[model samples]
Target: MMKKADVGDKTKTFHKGQAIYKEGQSSGEAYIITQGAVGLYRLAGNKRVTLALLRPGQIFGEMGVITGEKRTSEALALDYTEVIVLDQTLLHTLLLKSPRPVQIITSYLVERVRALNALVPERSSSNTFASVCSVILLAWRAAARSGPKSEAAQISTVELSRTIKDILLITQTEIDEVLEKLARVHIVDIVDVKGTYYRTDPLLGTKKKSGEFVKERLLSIPDAERFARVSRNMAQDNPDANGAELEFIDLDDFARAVDAQPETILKKIAYGEVPPALFHFHKRQALAFAASKGQDYFQRAKRPRLKVEDLQNVDDVVGVDNATLEEALSRLGFYKVGVLAALAGDEARQKIYANLSKKIASVVREEVQRMPEPDPGEASDIEDELIGLIKSIKGISG
Candidate 1:
């Protein structure tokens, strides 16, 4: 019969309903409940699924200790309980004293479980900061495997993309979006490495010259875990289950909105730095982007194709009788005013000269910068669309 053992290093008492450990936390030692009960649970969507309840003489947390894995379940003190803590050293010693065949079989089983875990589909989070944290940890593990170079770890986007997708529900495009933001925030550097890898064709596989994206970081990791926690808790900020909340920009207000220019944003998207999924673009460019990706990137941002609303914000409207100003904003019926905002780069600021009050123009310019741009070949198509919109606005308003 199983019996409670006092061989463990120390003992402690936990009040009822106290958390002994949470899921996804680092594990080192195992616990034995000498008194009271403990419960193991996990979060499945919004529901908590209880896995087990343990009482005296039962040992728990051995799996995490055996595999050096994160705690897969939350252990709560089901009642006021006395527990014994068995540290890593004692666990290692105990394992060493096990029978030879038992040791061999246990090691093999542990290895098998780890290998199978990769085949399981799981989503840790879709939060940008959390994704960033996960990437850093994954990169460190990969770098350690290859023997890290210098004080930092380096990893190609390709391998990092593959590993992240295997474990999380995120996609390649999503990963790229997170990496670009991380680079902008100075947490990581995106370097273009010129190289040749075998390219397979219908007939033959040959070496091809191309640029590989690699994310490199300094040896330091600061507040990554803490930031991830904050982001995860704030994941509810994303409303309605869309990948990201879509923000709209009215092109008729483009000129008034600090001459709204999307060139920089477009270049980033066309070059694949920003995911096309974030933007709303019409014309053949939008169709082509959807066709190339086998998905509707523009569908995320829903906006009216044509607006002919009567201007009704009598209290908010600042009197402006000038034809250009009227055409830029009054006719469009969207006068979200605030004008000191700027886009990401210097090039973006030049296209925007505010006619819509200093404060409103700045804010509009920032939104325009937030909008997407297109490739050189696709640029003419979108530019033509913009020209047509400008022409229609002028002709109709008159």
Candidate 2:
């Protein structure tokens, strides 16, 4: 029988299929699987892939909780299970007081390390060091992000992979494959203990850190020069605009508008430092330049996408009864239905019948019947046409 002290803490119960904790959340405590089972999984590519399953007597989350790291994989209860929660502080204190506890923890950590080594391929001596460096760099960034708050100075593999994918413009699989190759050379250490953490020697070959390597690659792009030139030209043209104006140019205006700046604007621009052309800025160069330099420029504001809540309000106003408007909004994408419903008073609905087509209008009419009768100003025809537009756009059955 397990002693109360050996359990070290109280057991928490979870139903089958319930989430014990999600991936990416901060690790609060580790768990000992006292009864039932739990499955650990992470998002691999587009799918949730199971990394491991724990049965009775096995401990999980020790690596991350002890190290104060973010969870890499989600833990889901495989059945009605009871888990003994081991608070990091309390566990550490207990471990210090008891030789038996220290031994247990040491054995657990060793077993975990051994298990990870068996699962991951060993790094070889013959592999390209450059690729190995890249993998190590990514792994370092990931560990930095996922490490504890005190060591919060770390990055997680997911974040590192995302940055590399964006900078290198490669898929996750491509990044994973590169890491796998580097893992073969032992240049990068990939550990599957708790959340996957990576470690690498930055001084292995290159003097440059991973960040410097990525920055160098970015600066070397052919478009980098062109983007810089265009941005400088735009800045010169908008000499009157303040630095903030240049920095916060709206997307639409940034692409097309060009106009002279006022004296006051020029004074502000003089005080402001020119911002660097980063990846996102480079992608929207035309927009950024236009907003900075174009005369009579107006940046188009992005409209909020319509949501289910919008449809519910429309249903309340229109006298549509019976069917829940929320359900209808889901069937017809919210924005599509909301934009059409907004046209309830338009004159075009009545005159544009033949142009709009009957099938489209019929669906709109059916939906409107659920809502309350429109006010005197509301035109049923316009509402019908709006529905028609939605059906046409979504290819929904009229």
Candidate 3:
């Protein structure tokens, strides 16, 4: 018989301006906002952008625990906030037994996948144009929120190009051509500053100020028309996309919503496995690999990509015993260790390599302490060389 695990109840409170979790920190707990509001934000360039606000009865900080990844963003209290914490054990137990929890998780995952799939450009030129236009409109609306009062929103072309590239799997040339088309149509005014910037007036022209400029242009554009049709199809399959509110995420990011390994998921698709229903492609392969097994295989084949110590930090928050945490973490996926070796002078990068060396030594000591083994002289030398290289780079950068 399997034993039921004991997960203690833990509730925490935070004052306004206090961080519930910092970006890059390890997390194994999901928090439900019980009182006041919580702010969800991520670093945008050099600034912090509030992605969303969680009010009473809303949930936050669940992604990290579910995906077994470090925090991708920071969460702070917008005001005084109280949260009920559900540790990993409890969450896994609920996942196995509760339909409600599964449904909530599925909803979030499906929503994210749909958003990602929609960004994939259709082969038709018109459809590609529509994707670009839709992206521009989205950026324009974002700029409007920043209090631009001249009826025209100033959008940095470089930033807009980056946004389009991030959201859609498109090349720079495609994006540039789309911008040129919009400029020719008088829909967007291209201005040169330090970089190319675009000024788009949502209420441009009109003999009557009918407030239909945007709608009319969208209706007339072959690409925009195709985009709306595609959006309708997406809505039919994903109930979350049926309404006015929509959130977009990159294809890689969709994996985080479902607690799956991002690279593993991408690899499955790359190898011609059947994607989920939210994807536009029909399931063509009956014997396709499963995501769970794929992740397990990937981990075994790869070197440590992220810091193992950071993973251990997550276990600390969950209150898992050291032995158990080590055993569990030892089996998880890691990125290739030497991939970052070429990068120089980053403090964070240096610390990661240093920590990797320490973790390697600690694991070897624990596994061989009671057994007769050869001296670790060769392994120690390798660690020393790696550490020395990092220190040299740091010295130069400093």
Q: lDDT of each prediction vs. the true structure?
A: 0.53, 0.50, 0.52
> Which tens-of-lDDT digit does each residue in 254-295 have in candidate 3?
665677876666644533454564463212221243443565
Highest TM-score: give the candidate number.
Answer: 2
Candidate 1: 10-residue stretch with minimal lDDT: 334-343
- Tens digit per residue, CA lDDT, model 1, 1-398: 22335355488889998999998999897888889999876653322445578999787887789888898778999899998887877777878987999899889987775664443224333344454444455455446445645555556667667655643556778777666655555555556655344455646665564545433423333344443454445434532221221123322223235553544443344435566555554345357656887756645854222222222221111222235333544323211211211212332233223344566566666665664553445444333333343446556441
Name the Cα RMSD for model 2: 21.7
Candidates sorted by TM-score, descending order? Answer: 2, 1, 3
Clashing pairs in 3: 304-335, 305-334, 305-335
lDDT of 2 by residue, 346-378 (tens): 322332222233665455555555655445344
- Span of ten consecutive residues with least summed lDDT in model 3: 212-221
Give the count of colliding residue pairs in each prediction: 11, 34, 3
Worst 10 residues of 2 by lDDT: 212-221
TM-score of every model versus the real structure: 0.30, 0.31, 0.29
